[model samples]
Target: MRFTDLISYQALLEPSKPAIVAGGKIVTFGMLEHAVRSLSGRIHALGLQPGSLVGLSIEVPSRHVALSLALARCGLVSVPYASAATLSQLPPLALGLSDGGLVVGSAAINLVVTDEWFAPSEQPVPDVAIADDADCRVFMSSGTTGTPKPIFQSFGGMDAQAQVVANHHLLAGRVSRILCAMPLKSAWGYRSTIAALANGIAVYFAAGTADIPMTLAAYGCEYLICSVYQLQELVRLQSETMIPLPSLAAVCTGGSLVPAELVRSAQSLLCSRIILIYGSSEVGHSALEVAGMHPWQDGATGFVTPWTEMEAIAEDGRVLPRGETGELRVRSFAQARFGGQPAPDGELPWFYPGDRGSISPDGRLTISGRTVDILNIGGTKLSSERIEHALKRHPMVIDAGVMGVADRQGLTEVRAAVTVRGAVAEAELRSFVATSFPVAAPQMIKIVAAIPRGDTGKILREELRALLN
Candidate 1:
């Protein structure tokens, strides 16, 4: 079902229910639907084309959901942008989104074709959402070099994915409150904004990653669907019992493998179980831990929804046995993408988004790692995640980062940097790492107060590379 349909459903069935709570204000489903419909009229009144882009710059709350819904309702494409990217990055982000079309909003940057997008209501509309044969909904993803990739999305691709979320994750008759912590400019972030709304769950918006833990505590957020790094930080901060989480039910960690210790700790500390989900900006939220057992431990590691058809394929393009590990190729025509890319895989009905994972013997699923995050030591292939997971386990370490650095001789070295909770010398960490990975002892180590993180909580690899260099 399309995301817009849920608004109508909630408006009729539970119209007075809280649809959004932000900045000490609560908007009910009926009120939210009216706001969306009215805002959609305002958006359309801008004389934008049927599939042209309409930007939403709401910073405090309701930015993503309202904009996504209104644009979907009006048949105008909506492109959301995070206001926090570097100034040098904004201009390119705007130009990339505009694609020769008019731009809008003050949140991303100042308006106009050549400059950055504007903040919400802070700048004039950059471009009219005019008629466009081209795809709507431009999403920016982080490049390997730490640049943003402009991926287009069609309205159809979005709806198809929302159905999967509505069926697989959202339980019926259960009072759920979805916290929007991830920025909406990302496909995953935008989808999370609307996914709960698509299922008629009350939505709570956290200004950014900074506000998540406190905001989630304040709202008694039942379900948190956001990046794993943010969740990890939240779990870390919530290690103490003073933080109130009376209403929190499920901790949904995406963007990477949910740390098992984090899950167990959150369950003990905040009284909420971690629900681990594996997904991407391109594929939407896919395999979730199976329900039951501990709140954090899904009996199965793989997603079990009927809406999506998934296969694990090997390097040679052959489908792997269910018990083996491979790339996760999936298809869902019922869901919509940001661009008009034609149902992902077209005739084949599958999309392999460069993730490496496996389906277990018991039909459970586990995401081993991402294919894009490989590290080369000389010629040996090492999963960066494996090293990261190992490093985070150290008690004195708050965070750890590993990058492939080459020696003067040209042999690649597994270099590490760590943020510590207590005093830790480089040699001490090196000693620990040597004990752990005897074969691949890191030759270099740096003690940083905190690993530099991009807006998405990913360490800035380019910045780290600069550090190593």
Candidate 2:
């Protein structure tokens, strides 16, 4: 079923139930359905085909959410761009992803949806049939390299993945209110929002990271979905004043490497269950760990979900035994595809998630690092995540990023950049690293106000290297 249908079902069951809260405005399920249907009727008047691709560039979360549901109801593939992207970046991104159609706020590129389109008329919400194989949504990859690649999710895949997320998180009926602090364009935000709405849960969109605690307190939200960096900032803020969010039961964090220290601190300050999720756009949640229920290790990402299959493979493409570190490959029941490629030949096809990790004999997964972020220094391979984890152990360091840069002699040398809470001597940090990891210690350490990161909180290795140069 389409995502809009989920909203419609909720509206049918509880029309007066709060559906979305954004920009200090609350929209009930009934109001949401009416707006979606009205907007969808306008879209259908544009003569766009069922399977046509459309780009969404709306800035307001409420409007963005409404238009997204309208597109789904119209059976059109929606490619939502990050509202914060520059004007110059939007054209290329829309052109590359959308099929000659773009919707920016209330305006349309190839078609117009004016006041007349939404005027009183009996247009019966245009009966459009969507095939299961048709592309339902296209999510842009968070890679820092060339043009962002589009990851397509079929309608069936979207529903299945949403179900898996809802079931795994115990979101259905159990969660009444949730707060989303991530960008709407992100896969995590899109999928999580759908799961919440499908489960008839009310969602509140925080204005920014600073507003999250207030939003949660104001809405009395029971759950929060945020990135690791946001969680860290919240923990830091909690240390100052305990933001009253007594209803908050769980805080789900992912989209980057989550420090064990951050999890422990958040649990103490927030007084909520902290869940660490490990997954990517290509594959829905593969593993997760709950703070109090699961044993929190330095790099452990929890155990693989029952609906997913995971394996670690060596460079030679041979599957490694448990306890051996290698690249992780996962296959889920959701059957996610990279772009348009089908799963490889097997009873269940495996999709390599580009992360290096290992599974223990008891089925716990430990994420070692990213395959692309591995650093080669003096012929010794080192995981950047390992080095960053070590740096964060320092009392003064709040954040750290490590990368490999070339030296004057043309040899690769490990370089580290950090964001510290207070003044920290370079020699002191170097001595701390040298004592713990002498062989893989960074050759140079630079203290900056903040480390560079992409939208998903992954460290931009190239950007970090540029800072060193």
Candidate 3:
């Protein structure tokens, strides 16, 4: 499959199915297909070769979905860039991709002299050809290490990943709608779009955070995919509004190491099972929760396919015995970026996804913390996840994030920020946390409506750091 066939196949079978609802606009599968066919014709007229790489920088809309599916139908490789990129970044991206493309919605830089703009399009970028082995899209890292590395994923691998997300999160489901912020351009958005389209469901997008529920009600959405943090926020809102939301089925929050508290709260609020989906643009299956009525059963090591195996290995480079904590690693179903290195055949490609976890005696896996999320608090080594897990046992604390901020003398104190159950006293919550874990008791606990989460439900550590300062 060339990846574009996701919605195309469904359009033939269930053309009347709703495909997208943005604002008040609703696009049926039949209508979206027509738009794609027409836009593809316009795309070909633009002289961009079929299978060529093109970029899109636009807000989420029916047209965004139409153009992407059209490109897939037309066999063009697409990379949807974040709006955060600077004018200085475009020309280099253009030169490196070597695909003559233009900014879809920008006027200032497009009008100014630039080698990147072959011929500008105020409309979406057109379709071009992409090879089976060719790079389909490039994912830039968060620039945590100064500048982010642009990671390229293959079209074939991404197709398999779509299957993973669908099966793992129940997108191979019967639902009326799917929702996201279009936060990540890769599987989070692309595969999500494909999964829903493949299953003949509608996808809805809220213009901003304030309108999430309004967007759902407006679109008649029933299924949602968000970062863990987004789910917590939703729960906080639901607790307040006391309004019945669009009937939800399943929720999958990716793009970071999602917290169980986020899952627990959303499960209660949405009245649906919350499955933690672990994946990245490089490879989709690090692991995932099993589907079915018992999806969140404590020990399921994500729905595994015949293509890969999951491992928990210690710092000593040995796969840990069951019931021990170590770094989580994976072998891919397809060739992918393994620990920042290229895969070689028959080698069983592996990469540490920065999660710290333990394998159970029953052969199930449990994630404990991030491999990099370790610190020495007064010479006692502690993983932030341990304190968090213990702290969340309290009913009042809905979600919690712990960080060991070390000062000048190398003394590190653990700081905990909590998304509480509606409104709870701050001092009492701190005392509750202090009484939970003796190893790294929280010196402080701040309650908010919800914790700050990035695209994926992982607590934004930097944002929490700012809260204390």
The best candidate by TM-score is 2
Tell me the tens digit of each residue's lDDT in model 1 across 243-332. Answer: 777777666666665656666666776554556666556556666653345233322345534555677898888989987878777755
Give all candidates' CA lDDT scores.
Answer: 0.62, 0.76, 0.61
Structural similarity to truth (TM-score) of each candidate: 0.79, 0.89, 0.77
- Higher lDDT: candidate 1 or 3? 1
Candidate 3: worst 10 consecutive residues by lDDT? 107-116
Candidate 2, residue 112: Cα displacement in angstroms equals 8.6
Ranking of predictions according to lDDT: 2, 1, 3
Cα lDDT of model 3 by residue, 1-469, tens digit: 6546666777788888777877777788887777777666655555554546556654546756666665565555555654445323433332112123444443222212122222333455444556665666555544321233455567676677667656654642567677765464544666677666766767787766557777766655667777645665677777677566756666666544445555666666765666656665556656566234444543244544456666677777888787787887776765454245355875756766677777666545666556556767777766776677666667777778887877777788777887765667766666665675565776667665666654435565667777755
Ordered list by TM-score, greatest first: 2, 1, 3
**Model 2 misses residue 150 by how many Å?**
0.8
